[model samples]
Target: MHRPALRTLLGARALARNPARRAMPTASHYHRTSNEASTAMRQPSTNTPRPPSRTGIAARIAHQLLAPCVLALSLGTSMSSHGAGPAAAPERPPAGTDVDETRTVAQRTRAPADCLSVVLEGVTVLLDRSELSRQAHAKPTQWKTEAERMALIEGRRAAALLQAAAPAQGSSPACHPVTQTLDGDDQFVVLAHLERGAAAVLPAGATQPVPSVAIRYLGQRCGPLCGRGSIMVSIPGQPQPFMVTHWWAS
Candidate 1:
């Protein structure tokens, strides 16, 4: 009776130590389960998705946000870094050639009307009103040199065109003059041609001896900056003169 009682106590203790063994699992069963759990922890399932790294996320963001032009510039930079040359852009006009660069333009005048407007053959010109009036009625200036005499003669002729035309307003789209700085001031000059010519309009206070073509001088003649300029116009027998803008280095 005593031995049986002792055996029953030991069995109760063994049951208390392993209460999870309700099915009375064998050693092999435990081994198989341990191996499966370790393997599952070591290797994730193939179908499970992984989170992206920091670098990969940044690259995707940049690809979405960058523009095509930015990408092209980046490509150019990259090529240059790899000892490849980049294409050069023009900085200034080529020398020795009178470039018909009508594209190069100064500031738009907003129709300020700094100079007086004069029209001959329907083409308009801007000039100093006082200077034109003085040149129109002035006596012969002393001929210091041939160039000086020619300059005075041209000024008189230009003043005549101003005197012949009445008070008028005109605008030119082709007057894309270049701006140059001299004596702390900016200067620009332009020339326009008339498509057709009309008989001289002899209004009040007109200048005499109108010619077929007239050359006007704005600044001092022959300057890198706009010190002076001369332009010649060929007139036609038509009634109305339409201005045609021509751009040249002045």
Candidate 2:
């Protein structure tokens, strides 16, 4: 009986020492499967962000380049509008060569009711190509001089038309004249033909002499090529004779 008891005790002790061996293998396998499934169900991780595409990069570069060009073009246009910069003025051809120029002048006086003075001035001229050529010959060293030469000629011709219609101060009973000078402050003819819109109003294909009657006036004749200048005249005992004031030329 003792031996049988001892054998039973030994068998229990062996079972207690090896719990893994005593536990149900099926239960352990199920627990392990549950843990593995939980691990597998975790959320996926993200990767780092990518850079811009080639097309996008190229577009950005193009925009950067275009912005400066647009700004430069706009700046150039604004500078041109004010006539302040060194940019060249537009060149116009001389009158009466390709196109005809004619002018007329009329005057009224407050001092005398019967005194009505009228004069007409006109000329037909070609652009002095020879003069222009002479100026052009010096263009390499004197571009500004050449430019001034041409401009002076044009301005002078326009001034002559104005002088021919100058009002008179009755210096004599004949030769009513209109005039101006190169100086801006000097008095010019009240009926000067260089005024704006006069070109359209002037008669075509005719040159008429300023009449000399019932008034004294000084007349300054312009050379065929008048330099920038004006003519001056006065209407006797009048407050103001200039009905119009401004400059125009073809």
Measured on C-alpha atoms, candidate 2 has an lDDT of 0.32
Q: Give the per-residue lDDT digits (tens) of candidate 2, residues 58-147.
A: 778766764554333222121112211122222222221222222333321111221223323332111122222332243232236634
Which runs in model 1 stand beyond 4 Å of their true positions? Answer: 1-115, 118-126, 134-142, 167-250
lDDT of 2 at 170: 56
Q: Give model 1's TM-score versus the native structure.
A: 0.24
lDDT of each: 0.36, 0.32
Using lDDT, give the best candidate's number: 1
Point out the worst 10-residue segment of candidate 2 by lDDT.
193-202
- lDDT tens digits by residue: candidate 1, 24-127: 87999999999999998999689888899998987776545543423322221211122101121122222222332312112222222333443434443334
